[model samples]
Target chain A: MSVPFYDSGVASGLLSGILFGYVLEAAGFGSARKLTGQFSLKDWSVFKVMFTAVLVAAVGLYLLRLGGMIAGNSVYIPTLYLWAMAAGGLLIGAGFAMGGYCPGTSLVGIVSGRVDAVVFVVGMIVGTMAFAGVYEPIQGFYFAAKGPDAQRLPDLLGLPEWLILAVLIVVAIAGFVLGSRLERARGGPFTAEDVNGEDTSKAKNQNTTFNTEAGIVP
Target chain B: MTSSPRPFWPPLVAGAALGIALLISFLITGHGLGASGFVTRLSAQISGWLAPDLTTANAYFGPFLTAGAPLASWITWEVIGVLIGGYVGARTAGRSRLMVERGPQASVGQRFAFAFIGGALVGIGGRLARGCTSGLGLSGGATLAVAGFVFLAGFFIAGFVVSALVRRAWQ
Candidate 1:
């Protein structure tokens, strides 16, 4: 029933990573402007793609667990560190906003032959080194508010996992609906034509209008 | 390029494909997608080689040494795959080009500066959170880990606020 190579961590990691990277690039996430579009409300592709992926994976994993095909504990779930996670999230968000790329997307950017992405990756390495250099001082805050090992929402909320999943599905759908409306209000949904080639003059014009409307002088 | 580049796949389609990839990862590796961990390990390993005493004495980079060769880890191979897959995807679509992406008004220097600073912040933050968007946001969220949602909330909220302030960078 099980694939022999699946047991090999290296092989599986490479297989999964290729799929993951291909999907990211094909989704246009290789472009920083396209990704930061979410923050500007100009394009909902980032939100749509991310939410869809989350919903599908969550549901699929849950079903697999229910079917006893995958043990519940086999999948990795990160420990809950409320303060560390929150603070870290804030910093990452700021970085995302300022940098126009995340760790994953930045890699896609590099392969897409982006110089900025290369710089970003170099900076990322330096940042990690810096954190290590200062880890001793911030060790307490980094590990503060540690919760139960591998805690999930259901565990924290005292609700059935299925019920939470159902609710999340509804929420995601609603978010999509809202996202569409927001895109419409801004101008229109961003399309592949916007980033497919050198013919971005039209897209550029549209961006100008959106920025002007948003009260930013570009 | 002479011909127009191919358009990217629709968001929903690509998202579904990514989800399936994630599911497969779980079925095989018993974990989901990740990126920052690889960078951390690589950095730690390199630093270990340069200054074995300092790297091992540090609280953060020290632990990575115990896990054996950093390049031999699962995440390391996965990240290498990411590079290969990304290159293939870009090449197939004719989207591969050497350029610095930025707002029209933003100078090249500005873009580079922001990109580096932003990346550094992401590295620090990802290390602190023990995951990045892919590792924590997507993987943790799918597992319904409270840490995942919490990180997502802070990420989006700060993203909105900061992007607004730095709108000129990528408007």
Candidate 2:
């Protein structure tokens, strides 16, 4: 059908970001406290949403591939460079935990009116410039030990895609079950105030009664 | 044990929706999600606008210049959507807090410093790895990319370790 428009990358990028922003907003992810609370076990919304998204996408993509709607190979799967990814993740993670916002979330925070978000963003630019400055020394090592970029868990484990998808779905279900139980065990009504100080029950109820009705533990 | 009182989407529901968005992306465009790359690209544009001569001469900004589309690129528009969407989300949810988030014990200056440091690390790290948590960890992982998984694991480990070290920040 010759569907990827010449400017399609831009269109796709715009659509993708809008969808992402909607999802993040719907889930009440524009707050630093709620995000950071995930690490403290004070709130598990981030984990819940993140894992759920991964599970759904995994299952959906596998199904789409099976249906021949999307060619698995055409998708942009990154190359597996072990050291660079691990190191980069470590640094980014530290930033997330301490800063209470990742690069994306910090932008979210900015919209939510946190001055700290602006500061974090500024830091991000400086950091990027710093990376550029040192690109030469690091570039060679960063791309080193390059392995098959196509290696996925299923490929590494030599399992069928359906089986892997099934396992992931099951795991996601298990997480939901465990998370609910954990909240129940603690014994309290959940509130947006506790998570990020925003009452999302009413807002979310317009969206999903299953969660708000389920009630968060104390 | 006190149960968490914050009301938000159940993890499963939110994740599934997010996954669907990504799956839609793959089917429609043959790619996963992203954020940081565009940030770097936009930063380059700003640098260029601020200094045409230096930006053109700089080795790093060279690639983006080759692409020929300045501020009008897709990434810039997407980020604009992010701001608009985020604002809409926060306003709709009534979460528009015009305050600097810091631990009760720390001063605003101290919190700002950590945030700045942390942000810089993310900026640099995102560039080095060619993506950030969203671009690499979440989106890439969903695509079952090996690099995505590595990045995720590395990110979580680093976050958990540093969380302890910087416990006071959020405490």
Candidate 3:
């Protein structure tokens, strides 16, 4: 009883990435301004899309595993490296605030024809090289924690996966419910330019002209 | 351009679809989804190609070179597809436009600098954590991985904390 074809490694990576990319674009993450706005009290599309995707996947995986459809242990989980992951997370987060795009969003941004996104991609490559050059010094801390590799939240908390997942779903629902309102309060429906405090009438005009030219009814 | 906020897939629907896709990945590959691993592998390969002796000498690069997929991996292929799919989705949705997006107050040059710096940080961070948002936050969270939880917690805190300092960039 194997699960499905699209679930495997390389194949699923391709499928999931494509789907994820589509989802990201649909959420308007290709626009750096839209993404950065999540940090602002302005718009929260990033939170909305990200949490939605996470909760949906969390519940889905929980149910499938509970149903005996897939072996939970078979799922790939990285070995725990506390210091490395923490430091990396902080660095990456700082980068997010500065750059406004994750690896995933940068790809989508580049696809959507954003020049900044392209520069971001090049930066990623350079960063990788920089890290590699200094890999020797960092490797020790990076591989420091060789804890029980069978680490999972449920296992760590000594709770059932189903129960933990259920709680997560509830939290996601609440967040979404609250987030929508917060977004509206911040700025109901402003363009990236507007949210950034730029004169957005030009963007509005461009939108109207494009819509009229393309015969799009909106 | 319609000025109307484009409709997004409902959160629940989008989540479920993403979940199913992740589930499918687990079922087929005996593992879940990932993004950073490819970058790590690529980085390793690039290092090896650039300086075989140095790559081989490093303990980190040793196992990956021997144990992992070849340079032309499925993950690499999938990333390529992600690029294509992203392009298609953006174009169809009228979201495809060539522009440097930044906070209105942020200069194009400043934003570009941040974009590069942020990207570099992500590259290193993903490798250090053994995953990125896609790998740790999404797939690992789905699978209930402890590392995933830790990574997510760390990332959110860092993002929010730094967000304040960079306020001028966004608005």
Residues B77-101 of candidate 1 have per-residue lDDT tens digits of: 8998899899999998887777888
Candidate 1 lDDT, A147-176, residue by residue in tens: 999999999999999999999888878888
Q: Where does model 3 exceed 4 Å of error?
A: A4-13, A188-218, B1-6, B10-12, B48-58, B61-70
lDDT per residue for candidate 2 within A1-218, as digits (tens), equals 43222234666767767777767766767666667766655566766788778767777777767777656576677887777777888888888887778877787788878898899888888888777667767777788778786778878778887787788678767866776666455442234455354334565446444554544423
The i-RMS of every model, in angstroms, reads 1.8, 3.2, 2.9
Candidate 3 lDDT, B1-171, residue by residue in tens: 354334545545655566666665566665665666666777778777888787777766666677654356667766776787778887676556667777768888898888888888888787777778877777777667777778888887888888899888877
For candidate 2, give the lDDT of residue B70.
Answer: 53
lDDT of 2: 0.73
lDDT of 2 at B153: 80
What local lDDT does model 1 show for residue A175? 81
User: lDDT of each prediction vs. the true structure?
Assistant: 0.86, 0.73, 0.70
lDDT of 2 by residue, B1-171 (tens): 222233455555666777887776665666666778777987777777877777776677767776685566666666776777777776666556677877667789989999899889988888867789788888787877778878978887777688888878877
RMSD list, candidates in order: 4.6, 5.5, 4.2
When summed lDDT is taken over every stretch of 10 residues in candidate 1 chain A, the lowest stretch is A209-218
Instruction: State candidate 2's TM-score.
Output: 0.86
Winning model by TM-score: 1
User: All models, DockQ values?
Assistant: 0.70, 0.51, 0.57
Question: Model 2 off-target regions past 4 Å?
Answer: A1-11, A177-191, A195-218, B1-7, B50-54
The deviation in Å at residue B72 for candidate 2 is 3.6
TM-score (2 decimals) of chain A in model 2: 0.80
Which predicted model would earn the best lDDT?
1
